[model samples]
Target: MSDPAPVSTIVFDVNETLLDITTLEPLFERLFGDAAMLRAWFAELVLYSQAVTLSGKYTPFGELAGGILRMVGENNSVAITDADISELKSLIVSMPAYVDVKPALDRLRAAGFQLVTLTNSAPSPSPTPLEKAGIAGLFDRHFSVADVEKFKPHPDTYDMVAKAMGVEPSGLCMVACHVWDTIGAQSAGWQGALVTRPNNNALHAPNVPTPDFINSDLAALAGQIIDANTAAGKE
Candidate 1:
């Protein structure tokens, strides 16, 4: 049997990739008045996501956010009301994108690449921070893993993206700052690109699958993708 064709669609991981979650730290600290507790809460939210997926229990990302915040409150000896939790959830929907996002996305689009965004966030009442960032229209499709009820490093979540985008796993490149996410995509038979941002220092697990490409920024990645596609006759 012949191998599948080279990649054609470029799917991005939203949170730490296109969007900058660091901007939300001040907001979280202001709301909780404990920076350390807020950081721990964010970390725990990731832990819970994996736990829930492994246990076959699914919760919306918004619900997980609230639950994590409440856990932070409990740990910090702070009392948080339901209303406060609701407001905090709303704030989460407004987190800003990274400064380089718009130009990078525009370059990719201009290069004739099909662009899509795949996020672990839930479908919210209002436009997500990506939409607010003025780059939402740049994406051919925006998908939330909420539909699949799974999180990153879960094959199901990556599969949901491939199915929705109407592309074979081999024809898609999953790009993210998170190594685990890229590893998951690679494991699921998709090409993967790891964006090596400075603050993102999580080590790839031993014996975990490595991504097809790793670059320090999207501009570099865009160039590499174009060169790769040209060499593969996909351009």
Candidate 2:
């Protein structure tokens, strides 16, 4: 039997995986009078993004997020204004990278892995969140599901990255905090690494493909990926 391909490129999911989304808490608190609404609105944002994709329609992530924010506000009897939606979008694009992200990504780069990002968030003009966080140079490219008009966990989204990068799916490793993202990449024939960020967990279900690596810390996960790929090459 032929040996499986070694993972030469690491594909990261941005947003909550690398960037800290909790930075929006103060805005949420000001708008809804409760910081916890941040999570509720974000959860809805993701859920509906996929729902829209499944329904054969497309809306940019930013637009969808804005609409969901208003929905959440209405559901909770809070009023969300146009300025509030604008502030939310601005905060999202300016979120800081988690402290562990830069160093861990640097480590992966030093190990000679091609690093890239696949996000549902639309590609904005310069000074994107990665640039604002000062880690944009660490990546070779940044991809968005926006290019394919679909939210992630959709097979075509992963395929777009693989095709654009000029590599077979097996040559890529998807690093994401959300199981749905990893599951999508794995289904597309890539290796999957799960970063167990807060509220994210490895799914345990029959016939589900578990991640090849799982860690709460990006640095630890980076090490595992590097070591595994190194050993695989040696064999």
Off by over 4 Å in 1: 1-5, 31-38, 202-205
What tens digits encode model 2's per-residue C-alpha lDDT throughout 9-119? 999999999999999999988987889888899899989999999999999999999999999989989888999989999999999999889889989999999999999
**For each candidate, what TM-score against the reference?**
0.87, 0.96
Residue 151 lDDT, candidate 1, scale 0-100: 85
Residues 1-235 of candidate 1 have per-residue lDDT tens digits of: 1122467799999877887666667656776765555557767888898899999999988798899888878877878789878877766777777777777788888878899988888776546577787788999988888888888879988888888778888889888988878878888988878788755543556777766677887878777777676777743
Task: Give the winner by TM-score.
Answer: 2
Instruction: Supply the TM-score for candidate 2.
Output: 0.96
Q: Which ten contiguous residues of candidate 2 have the minimum total lDDT?
A: 1-10
lDDT of each: 0.78, 0.91
Give the Å error, residue 162, model 1. 1.6
